[model samples]
Target: MKYFTIFASRNDTNDMEAVIREVYTGKHSIEKTGHDYTVTRKSLFNRWRIMLRVLSEDTNLDYFESNIPGMMGFYDHIPFADEHRKKLVLTQISALNTMIAIEAEKELGDEPFRLCKELLSKIGGIGFLQDGTLLDYDGQVIVYPDGSSGPADFHPRACTRKIRGEEIESEEGERRRQASIHELRERGIPYLDTLPQLPPVSECRWKSQEEIARRAVALLIVIQYACDAANGGELDESKAFVMGLLSKYGVEDQLTEDERRLLSEEQPDPQEAVNIAWQYEAYWPLIWALQLTDSLDFPDRICDSSYAIEAVSKWGSFEELYRQTALRSREDILDAADKTYRLHWACVNSRIQGQDAPAGMIESIVMERRRGLFWMVGCGMEDWDHIPMDT
Candidate 1:
């Protein structure tokens, strides 16, 4: 049942009233019973249109000008630009609602009355007159001022200047610049050669062969967990399960005919199996992990190694590890894991080949898969300081 009225100066009051009347003819019931017009509508959208139509049609009158029965009215007569003046009016309204007299204070007996007086004093241009007219600090009535009263003249607060005469370089512009430079350098441009040359890839830090071996062992422990989870915790069953996964992912192609025959024998050397897995260009660590788990009886090896523990935590869980391996998949979880393993393997080989391999090459590789696996199991790219470069 609560109602509010939109008011403007007498000059454009008729126009404002006419706009509201035409827009809400059949949609809402509008009554012009007294000096003020009342509008009733069940739909908030129609009510909003009433306000928007009134303001859009009449540019002379301000939109914030309103009259509430019990509250002091506000008016800004200064002829400043629309943008700058709106900020001041909004700031005043915000201060009134939040800081001056909060609605909650009304529940505290006479606190609301006391706060209203305090608010009137703090806001310099607002006061309640004896004749029910709200006047600003300059003695200008906010609503329907007398004919002799004129709009106040004040300096416009906003001004504009060109900060830079030229357009700034965007991200695309920087990218284009780099591409151009690279194209020039590829053609062996003489000017580019005069620029300082970067230090050789051999000078950069790289993973030692021993570190790579240790990482291979750590990955095996992780694969063991997956194998155990899939095969009901039986060591022999888990080994067969892991071998099935490997064979599905083309791990068999990486091994020689002799190595494949040896895998059928009982009690194969874990180190020898890992070395054979390392010969492949892709999926080597993953293949090594699978083979070593089948050959070695290293229980709790994944939970104990810092690297394995970190890798599991990054991949979320061993059971649902391959879920984030790619943006798209072929329905089978093992297939997805295989694809992810191959991609990671390619990235590691690229790093070992050279430092300046390609622009964003390492980043592209990490971004294509789960970032955590690279840090913990792959090349430790997340902890870039530990990432080994080729000499």
Candidate 2:
């Protein structure tokens, strides 16, 4: 459950170093030798450290979160400023746990996946119900196991019509109910299990899908600006840029011509980029929680994006930004990304689980960001030599 900041070298060399800075914990000594920097800490569960290890070995993964603990439990007991804040945190935890469960099912083998689901269910986090419906701890269904609610009723009339070579089909409503029932039986849920599963998590169907997509796209846009600024106000040929980003989300090949055209034509100013990044404050924490950069495609995006270039180019350097603005603007962007990510999960979880999304969740997230309470850059690069070699 420990938290740390990763400061990577901003140069283009095979010997780039990453400084792992531990925070909110006991002091640790920092040791530097050649290209490797280490902060000796007692904790064994260093997420970034493990991620780097995995990346260096180039292991194949079915899903990014499969091996990573959901980490939502860390926030469950932490006190927030208000009820709204507390709700926001809880909702985010639920959404994250749900996502983890989905990944487990998709990636793990039968025994391991079953155990994972059972463990989550026992912990009251999120997992599939006995009826194969996805749900959070509160018994709100998020995804239907059979992809439908129930089966259709048997109709004597339909049988007669078919026997006479006439087409007779069950009503859509009846078919849906029957399909749901059949799925419930297959998943071993009680035949009478009537727990309502509301808005489905089917792709492109959820009401908040558009909002999440918009925010995600905005994030890439801001990142593009940051990359450009770092590369002397020009796109970097070596860096992945927009196409690289689109690929991470598995949407690169699916982009319509119009979307591609817009991305190519749009030339947003630095201020506009910052403003767009700020607009999605609620999602930032979720992004941080999910450790989006840990995904296989993400490191390349970060490395290629050259966010540090912009940090240095616009603010003179990371050190200057850190000293003068307390890294306020950069921190703000990270915070927004995390919160917006959480808000999205909350909305998705609510829709699937048949629960109302927390009221004013987005507004509360934005307000918290404005208050400047949680300010920390989740990840970034810096000049290796500039980092202090002492705790």
TM-score leader = 2
lDDT of residue 375 for candidate 2: 21
The best candidate in terms of lDDT: 1
TM-score of 1: 0.18
Q: TM-score for each prediction?
A: 0.18, 0.20
Per model, state how many residue pairs clash. 4, 31
The 10-residue segment with the lowest total lDDT in model 1: 156-165
What is the C-alpha local distance difference test score of each model?
0.32, 0.31
lDDT (10s digit) by residue, model 2, range 105-189: 1224444333343433433444333343434443344334443322222111111111211221224323433455564345433
Q: Candidate 2, residue 279: CA error in Å?
A: 5.2
lDDT of 1 by residue, 1-391 (tens): 0111122212223444554455445655665543334444456743321112223112311222121101211233323244343333322322221111112211223432233333333333243333334334344444332212224331211111211101322443334334434543464321111111111222223333334333333334334533344333554665576566444433344333434443454554455444333222112333223332122111112222344334333543333443322211111212222233333333443444444323233423322222212322332233412222211
Candidate 2 segments whose C-alpha is farther than 4 A from its true place: 1-222, 226-232, 236-240, 253-262, 279-282, 288-391
